[model samples]
Structure formats: C-alpha cells, structure tokens
Target: KEIKDIVPFSLLTLHNEKYNKLQQSGMSQGKMKALLHNQAIGHLLKKIAPNVPEAILIDQFAKEEVYYSYLNKESVVQTENVYFSTKAEGIHLAVAAASILARYAFIKHFDNLSKAAGFKITKGAGAKVDEAAARLIHEKGLECLPAFVKLHFANTEKAKRLVASKYRK
Candidate 1:
C-alpha cells in the first residue's frame, strides 16, 4: 500500500473513555453511530494532518441531514481539499482504498481478539454474539467483560440480567 499511514484503534474497548461518555450522553442511536465513525475518521485525519495529505475523502452516509449537522454541530475541520459523496468508493480511488484498508484492519483486530479469548468472538450484535459474550461473562466473570466487550451495548444488559437470574435461585 502506498498510503502514508494507516492507524487502527479499537473504539469499544476497556481503555477508551469514549464508550462511557457515549452511554451517559444519551444521544440517539443514529447520532451515536455518527459520533463513533466521526471519531474514527477524525483520528486518522488528525494524525496525518501534520503531513498534510493531498486530499481527504469519504463515503457519505446521508444527504444534507447528517453531514450538514455534523459540520455545524461539531468542529470538523475542512479546507479546500475535503469532499463527501454517496459512492465515493466508485468515484474516488482514495475513498475506496481507505475503506479497504479499514476493513482489513478491523477484521485482523477481531481475529487476534478471538485468539486471545480462547474462542471465536463473533462479530455483529446478533444472538450468536450475545451467546458468546454471555458465555464469556459466565465463564470468565463480569470483570473480564470490559476486556472483550462493548459494555454499553444493550446486549450487555441482557447478558447481565441472564447471568443474574442464572445465579439467583
């Protein structure tokens, strides 16, 4: 890859304070997702901003709605070189390349996570993932949850309730 740098950080991990803030902020689900994406992309831009890359590009999530609000409501810096569009993947080589790199890093991170956990830590918030997480909580105990799970997720609550009942009576 000819990219200047590819920085990868896990958002929903024990070390990141953003997860706790997100839980307390009570933002709508859509806004919460946007905040997470914004932070991920923002971190990359901030890191490489020192090098002053040729251009920053992205795949637009929605119309005037999300972007406009994000721009106005937040301190998203944009100069002459930034652009956003629906299918930037199709139109802009940089956007497509970044997307691919991000996906590769994401999968690789989880693969290592699964290895460390001694089980296949499934992706996405479905029953299987819930089951795996609940099992981890049961076997490893609640303290270990922060190490591998996004504690703010509703599924965590459900898992906790299930665990409480299982050990109750």
Candidate 2:
C-alpha cells in the first residue's frame, strides 16, 4: 500500500548478463552497482521531469552522500531541486513510497533470478553467501556461475578459489 499510491514511477532492472559485460570493463563491483542505481534514479527523474509542475522532489537514499556525476550530470534536468536529507523517508511521504517500490522491485527480481539459477540465491556478502556460491559452482559448472550472479561481486573471486581448491579433491 505504501507504493500503490505513488503513481508515475519508473524502474530499471539489471540482469547478470549486463553486469558480466560491465565487469569486463574492470570496474569495481561497488562502483558498478552504484552506477547502475544512479542511472536508474536519473531515468526516473527524467521520466517525471516533464510532468513536474515547477520542481520535482526526490528522496535521497540513506547511503547516498556524494552525488554521482558520471551519470549525465550536464543534462537539463537539474539536481538543485533534489533533496538529500538523511532518512528522508521518515520525514517525507514521497521518500517512504519510493523506498517501498524499490524494495518490491528488488524482491521480485531476486525471486526471478533464484528460479533461473535453480537454487535459492541468498542476498548479501556473508559467509553463507560465499558457501552458496561455492556450492553453486560445484553443482553447476565453473562457467555457469555468471548466469546466476553478478560476476563483478568480490565474492566471485573467493567462490572461484573455493571451486578451484575443491577440484583437487
């Protein structure tokens, strides 16, 4: 219900294939993921800019401190109107609604990806995640791991090393 009222919202999903190609460009996983998110926000802003009456208000992500200028900063859509207050969701209805929409989209894609990988793909970069990746590599194949996860993730290296060590067994 939090998101249901927020109409005219835009969303973008990044699949593993896209991330694999991005990973080849030698970008760090965190930066690459941030770029994707920044681009998505830019897209949403662009979509609503025209409909906005004078100014478009945006809720800042709690983690977003520095503005990512690599994402078409020179574009006509100005950031002057964007609000970057911490915990803006708690203070603004728009922010709370956007957070809800973002979470819903994330969960939906996670489930879809899990189904495609044929195993429950856990979220985050914990020991369990590394174990899951190693098991996935062993059960599937060395090459198939990319089809299931963001290869740019640093965990991929640990998982790969684990897979290699297991091969000697």
Candidate 3:
C-alpha cells in the first residue's frame, strides 16, 4: 500500500499547515525548522530499516563541502569559505540523512509559499526572493505584503503607483 493511502489525509494536512506557518514566521524560525526536520527524518530512517551502508555515508559527509560548492552556480565564494570536518570520521549516516531531510523541508516550505501567495516562487536566496516579492505585490495587495520584502524595491514603488492610479480613476 502507498504511504499516502495508509497515512490519514487530515494528519498530512495538519502537518503541512504547521510547516507553512513556521516557515513564514521568520528566517531564523525557518532555519530552525529545517534543522529539526532533518534530524527527525534522519532518526526515523535509522529506526525503520538501515539499508544505507557505512561506506556511502562516510563518502557523502567527507564530500559534503564539495557538494555544497557545486551547488553555488554563480560564484566560487562558498568553495573558499565553507569547510566540513566530521569528528566521527567513519560514516556519517545520520548527518547525510539530515542533509537530505533539510533540503526536502526547504523545498516543501518554498512550494507552500508559492501556493499560498498564488504564484511560483523561484528557488534560491536572492533573485528568486525578489521575484517572489514582486509577484506577490502584483497578485496580492500591498497591505498583505510580508515584512521580509524591501518596501524600497523599484517594483514595490511601481506597484504602489499603479494601485494609487487605479483608485484615482
């Protein structure tokens, strides 16, 4: 049987609702949620069935920084700045699982924002966020805007003008 079918829809819905609320609260909150989710998922996976071998986990954590560097498509800055050193040295199965869970949590949060605000919010930390903010202004009223968005963005000023002009006419 499929996991979705087995798990009650109401439980899933509640989980998603809580997740979204936590995500929209603040950046720090979101980060904390992601970390917690990652740790929890990692523990759960270990509890269920351990198929992942020790060797693979060690290889993954050993190259974690390298993998993070690859993700930086725009600049080589992260490659220079970030470093990963595991004390365990053998195989970081829990850490690897946590990484996957954290990523999944982030994506789910992003998707939830897109759905709630009625547009596809792009992925990433900067440009995507700006695009999402602009889209939000276009779709939703200025009063409904999130504090995270810069009120000084050109698009935000333009949106204000458009709304004002519309009301004047």
Candidate 4:
C-alpha cells in the first residue's frame, strides 16, 4: 500500500513558546526536530491502533538515540520498526513524498504568517531575515513576534537592536 494511502496526512508544529522553552532547557536543534517527528508518528499510531505499519522510514534529522528515547516515551508503536537514514528522502519513495508534503505545508503556513505580519517573513538566519524581523517589530509590537518566529533565535536580539537604532535616526 502506498504510504500516503495508509498513513493519514498529519502536520505537526512546535509553537514558538514551546520551541524557545525547549531551547532554553538546553535541548539541541536535532533533539527538537526529533521531538516533532515523534509527535507526528505518535499521532498516527494512536489514530490507527493495532494496525501499525510494518516499518517506518525517516530521513535522519537527529541522533538515533534521540528518536528512540522520544518514541519509547511517547509512542505505543514498536521502536524496532523505525529506521533512520541520512538521505532516506532520496532513497525511499515514501520519505520523499512525506518531505514534499511537509514542504508544501510549511510554505502555506509561512504565507499566512507573512500576510499577518504585513510583509514577507524571510527564512533562515540571513541578513534579510534580520531586516524582516525588524520590520515586524516596527509595524507590530515585539509581542507579535512569538507567533511568527522562533524567539530563541539570535535574529530576535538583532531585530530589536535594529528597531532601536531606527528610533535614534
């Protein structure tokens, strides 16, 4: 059976507050990614109890131990069934399809966030992202950023400085 047919579509996100909290707790970025992946897998397993698929192929995002710990704690499914590879997305058709779906969902969410923020929110840690973040602060109060960006990123501080400098102008 096609993975898309057997596994229902699930989109999981870590809100900014949760993301910052985890980061503050000393969780590495890879562990955070594993946390989200575990959530999605757990959700699917609970939704289809007793009919768990034979195997799960995941593109490697974190250490295998990180995923195993999360899955063991949060999922009812067997950990032995899960396999991780550095480039599983390119090797496995199912992983590739899932990657495409995830990218599509991210783009859609980013678009909505841009609309709400009144400008295109840049991705990554580029200088342009700092400019966009500063714009976000200028247009909306700093409080609004929690909904649009990961608060723990250095860009937050950089943006604040930018906004303050603008006031001095």
Candidate 5:
C-alpha cells in the first residue's frame, strides 16, 4: 500500500529464516550485508536484456572490503555496471525507491513476526527491544531467539543479562 504510486520493476524479499541461518553459520554482519546486496542485484539483472545497459547504485554499507568481496563474486558480465555511493538514496531516485520498498517489506515482516509471537516486537537495539527480547526469552526460552533476532547484536547479551537477573531474584 505504501508503494501504490511507485511502479516496481523488480522486488526481492529476504526472510528471517534465511537471515538466522546465515548468522548461525558464523557469517559476519558486513559479509551478510554484502551477500544480500549481491543477491538483490543478481535478481534484478536477470530481468533485463543482456544488451541493455544497467547501472546499480546502492547506499554504501560502510564495509567496502566485504562489499567488494561479494560484488566481485556476482556475475562477472555485469560486475562493471555495479556502483556504490555514500547516501545513494539522496543522489538516485532508484535507490530511494528501493529503500522505500525495502522498508515496506521490513515492516510487513515485522508485523508477521509480532503476530506469531503474540506480542508487539519493537525494532532496533534500544531498551524497549531488549526488554521485549527478555520477555520473549522468559516466555519461550533462549532457543527461540534465532527465530526472532539477529543473535550477533549486542542486544542479545543485554536481553540475556536481563533474563538472568530476573531469575536470580
């Protein structure tokens, strides 16, 4: 609904299951970011004709080493067409549109997770998120976290400490 005015030529959705699997496999955040970006580009490239010129502008992920590592692993034929810029959303309409679409997808997935958890799961690694995660741990135990969190975030430790403190009392 948020993208009613935007005509989307290509869309890619990343599921939490896939994210959890990648994180559990010991993939660093930077590399995961790069892999996901590469997958999106690869998906988009498959839709267009081979002769058509395509320029991909992504907002810089702050991990140039990982970005370049995964970018080079993408289809070599289109590697030359990929480009990255700091704050690319401000410079390119396509990037901005993609950001909006990505946000919409995130919100939709968050809503689904919340529904499954029977509670409102807040976003970010703030106090509220930590508290909610602690509550999740309290109700469902730590084993359920990978289904609900990125595991590697500092918030995971915070939430664990919170749950532990509650148990000690």
Candidate 6:
C-alpha cells in the first residue's frame, strides 16, 4: 500500500522509458546509479529525526540491501560499506527510513508480480527462481509474468526449458 501510494503511474512510465532506452542503446549502466539512489534515499531518511538510533539505521540499510539483492540480483555494495560507519554515528535516521522503505518497496513489487502471475512466486531472483518462473509462464501463458521482472535475466532461458520439458512430459 505504501509503495502503491508513493510510486505513481508516471514513475512506472518513466522507468519503462528508461528501460527501453537502455535496451536499445545497449547501455545497461544503471547499476551504480541505482546504488547511489538507494544510498541517498537512505541518508535522507536517516536525517529526518535526531532521536532515531544509529543501530536502527544500520539495520535498515542492511535489510534494504539484502532485499534488493534477493529480488533483483543487484548488489547493494554501497549499503554494505556504509552500514557499520553509519551505525556508529547514531545520526542517520533518514538513511534508516530509506532502507526500510526500499525493503517495503521490494516486497510490494514481488507481491504484485505474484498476483499478476496468479501464483505465489518466491522472492529469490536466482537461476532456480527463473526456472520456476519460466514454468509458470509456460503453464499459465507468457501474459502471466509481471512487467517489473527483468526478462534479460539468464534464468529466463532456464525457465523456458523447464516449460518445454513440462509440456513434453
């Protein structure tokens, strides 16, 4: 619900546009940009309140990174590097809030995808997940896969094979 409220349709449109541009240009360079964005958001959230504990902020950052990595295979290296440093400062409320928000968003997105696919898809965005997703696509039809899932993931190919084998048997 929070994610649904904060991320408007316009943002989705913008993301789609950027994604298409990246695909067409063969750029695929947003990994760092995404990390920086997460870091900045986390920092900003941590700064919102002086009373918020540094431990909380650090936990939030770590959780957010873990969530993203699990869902997108995107390494949150910056978050890991700053986790201990920010926790020691005890003044990073904004970062903490941002981390929580990031995690919330990831879960919300995964839920949405699962809903679209008409099945409770697990959160691990690894090869096993891809294989499972491919089977879902084959069984339910391609239209079932959510738009947010990166089609370029190698798991997609594995999934395709899984689907083929299912039909063969």
Error of 2 at 100 (Å): 1.2
- lDDT (Cα atoms) of all candidates against the true structure: 0.66, 0.68, 0.45, 0.78, 0.76, 0.52
Off by over 4 Å in 1: 1-17, 27-55, 71-74, 79-81, 152-154, 161-169
For each candidate, what TM-score against the reference? 0.64, 0.72, 0.38, 0.82, 0.82, 0.51
Residue pairs of candidate 1 with colliding backbone atoms:
none
The Cα error of candidate 6 at residue 16, in Å, is 7.5
Residue-pair clashes, model 5: 0
Best by lDDT: 4
The candidates, ranked best first by TM-score, are 4, 5, 2, 1, 6, 3
lDDT (tens digit, per residue) of candidate 6 on 24-120? 5664434434444455545644554454333322333334544355336543433433443435334565444445566666677667766766777
lDDT of 3 by residue, 15-86 (tens): 433444555564233243334433433454454444532222222342554454433442222223233455
Q: Across residues 1-169, which tens digit of lDDT does each residue of candidate 2 receive?
A: 4455546566666677877887788755655545655566577667766665344444543333444444434343445555566677788676677778878988888898778678888888977788778888888777887777777678888888877886558
The positional error of residue 3 in candidate 3, measured at the CA in angstroms, is: 12
Global CA lDDT computed for model 6: 0.52
Q: Model 2, which residues run further than 4 Å from truth?
A: 1-6, 26-50, 57-68, 72-76, 165-169
- TM-score of decoy 1: 0.64
Output the better candidate (3/4) by lDDT. 4
Clashes in predicted model 2: 0
Instruction: Rank all candidate structures by their lDDT, best first, as comma-separated numbers.
Output: 4, 5, 2, 1, 6, 3
Q: Report how far off residue 102 is in candidate 2 (Å).
A: 1.1
Backbone clash numbers for all candidates listed:
0, 0, 0, 0, 0, 10
How big is the RMSD of model 5? 2.7
Residue pair clashes in candidate 4? none
Return whichever of 1 and 4 wins on TM-score.
4
